[model samples]
Target chain A: MSMVGGRRSLVIPGEIIVEGNFRAGLNTYLENGKIYSTVMGLAEIRGRVVSVIPIKSYYIPKVGDIVIGIVTDNSPTYWQVDINSPYMAILQVSDALPRPIDPAKENIRKYFDVGDVLLAEIALFDKLRSPLLKANGRGQGKLKGGILVEVSPAKVPRLIGKRGSMINMLKKELGCQIIVGQNGRVWINSVNEKLIDLAVKAVKIVDEEAQTRGLTERVKKFILKGKEKIDLESA
Target chain B: MDEEIKLIDENGLRVDGRRFDELRPVRIEVGVLKNADGSALIVQGRTKILAAVYGPREIHPKHLSKPDRAVLRCRYHMAPFSVEDRKSPAPSRRETELSKVIREALEPAILLEKFPRTCIDVFVEVLEADGGTRCAGVTAASVALADAGIPMKDLVVGCAAGKVDGVVVVDLCDIEDKYGEVDVPVAYMPNKGLISLLQMDGILTMEEFEKALNLAIDGCKKIYEVQKAALKRKYDFTEKLKREADKSEE
Candidate 1:
């Protein structure tokens, strides 16, 4: 059975086929091997069937997404980064850009020590299942001037919200650059340290209240009140 | 040993402002995993442990035979970055001993006779390790097993009491543990009022040991309450869902 306006179940992992006499609506796959109606809005896929999920807002890193990364390590270039996956990913220098040696002045650990969390993309997979990552993207570099908060990897989706709504709220309210590392590490940066602190607190609050409904409105109100309080105090 | 001390003071108030014999904040969430038969994540102070119960499945490797009782396999693993110093990926000897202790601790309470010829693997992963990791593992594992719906005689609560500079302190934090002379970790089934596991390190007089043991038992009793509440919360959630489904059907 096909759905109409409200929602439809995703039946298969392929493109959404809307043929003659077949109605189009928001389709989703059911576990019991049946396609059914959904209560969500309609989603349209391009030319081919929209088999895979959409990637408009917050980029949820898939198994293999070639993105830019930072050199979190030096000697061996052993880097830890987020590819939006569950695992705490690693990027080795051997696998990264292969240009060599200056022992006197250059220290690998200095390049990426304990606190120097970097940005890298997953490269190759080994038998032992370590993510061989690389840093070759445009916007990838050492995270600067941001407060990092570690959270449960499972909560990443909730923090990102349905369609980047939560993150957008923080961006608008705090006016800071917030980058969520898929490995449960969140980096928040702003010119005003207080705004950065507020953003971090807001993210944490959202994380704590992830299971609760209507969190968006609640958070929005919280940010507005916080902003007003700041304004009043400054005035 | 001589690092400027914080968290514990001359007045004996903990950083979080708990008096001596007080435990750090504990939050237990059970049945948190979709895949594991039973799972629990326990956070005591800053330390966090995720315990997953998988099995009563067929024993692997074939040769190690237990004709009567099911073999219990327990693995205690701390994430590489669980502590302040990044630990190596390999399981250290200390971790191995702790794993054995934990396995033995749970054995008596598990009713292994019921699942003879099978094996149960209890995996405890320390996402963050402060102090009292072994005790945390036991507590978390018991809750996870219960969350998995595994029948147990009673839940086990684990706690550590240590003597610092000759003063008996219950629930030693990281620094107290590092410099303190004595540490006695005990796991007990509060419902049965039986000790499942007991271990001590460093030097303690007989009287001191006994006092520490008693304090550990007290600490366990406190933790047991948390374990029960977590289990009840999870059960109530699932029960509520089932009742709603039943109502819909009706």
Candidate 2:
């Protein structure tokens, strides 16, 4: 068999990518011993697996994924969080606080009110109900004094790069705490306003040019170039 | 007095100067709206349509949510000034019927079972109407659905053919449709080789109906090429990057 991966082609939904038996991977469907793409993306036929990396898609929460969410509405039982996904997230009071609060006696709104942002992990998502979140874990709770930048969820893997190389580089260069959410939300915490602004710009650039190769290098140059300008003006 | 008007000129060309079995100029723009999860704008001759998709998300009214599969909701609306006359902005009977028709037409191609209990909303707004707005709307909404990154078996396309002046023509404009003997609009999935939507307006002989249906499917096959190009064109940067890679090799 020829190496089909050498000639990567962009395909729309229902376009056949392979003509023989192969395990259908992400964004692909298996029918009649053939593999077809189910979304608009670049097709990759590697060995026994054929997959397509979608260029743009909405967030779908999965178990153990770190996500940034805003508190939309809350009740005594749980707080309704919009994690940029179709299903609303439920942050149970027990999972959110060190000790469970009495719903009837204590005012739950004071704990996590509407419009507050938090970084949490998906404790459970069974595809039958909304995702249940746990925020009481270490380094997981209310996020304060940070800017949230949102991008397409499909670009999240690119923003992170292979084995977190791109994210580690950003953190080292900017000297800031950057949390890359699986739901396409990025949180940047820094004391310097210029550094925060640069991080936001860098995240947007990654989201825009994610389809092309060598994106991490281009982003590095942009940040380095922007950092120099900021230092010069401030000095 | 109205009978004196000729939709087909003496040179055997349509009012829009198209020959029989010829389609209107089709232009599609993907990801046109920034806010919509996925959006596309389709232009087929004088007809202009904007389609936006918002889900695979939560379905409203807890009772409406299905456990086994997602619900495909469609809204086909026309702007007040889309037609020559100022049409009512409210959903008319025809618009309501067309919405269901378009929804059923697109439902077969989508794999709704993957996202159970969610709602995939396809909104098609007719900004300008010529004649084949329903067919144009179906094609636009299909692109928008794919643009949303929803899994589907195939992309659905729509086209219409009708008998006018004892001749069958593809993609009839308003003037031809109004004076034509019969109109047949068809929604087809080329990859699956299936017809999802078929509607007829007026009477036709058995032979003419078969010929018109085949011609409309042929028109759909042609439009499918344009739809695929529009989806791929959304990533022009990818093409440029490939070009640069080839240059480095030389």
Considering every candidate listed, which one attains the maximal lDDT? Answer: 2
Per-residue lDDT of B158-232 in model 1, one digit per residue for the tens?
A: 999988766788887777788777888899987567898988888888898888888899999999888877765
Q: Once superposed on the true structure, which residue ranges of model 1 sit more than 4 Å away at CA?
A: A1-235, B1-8, B237-250
Task: Give the winner by TM-score.
Answer: 2
Candidate 2 lDDT by residue in tens digits, A150-179: 998989988898999899889988899999
TM-score of each: 0.49, 0.95
- What is candidate 1's lDDT per residue for A95-164, written digit by digit as tens? 4444764545666675556556566555665323435666646556466656778654446777788899
In candidate 1, position A39 carries an lDDT of 12
How high a TM-score does candidate 2 get?
Answer: 0.95
lDDT of model 1, residue B169? 81
Deviation in angstroms for B162 in model 2? 0.9
Q: How many backbone clashes does candidate 1 have?
A: 18
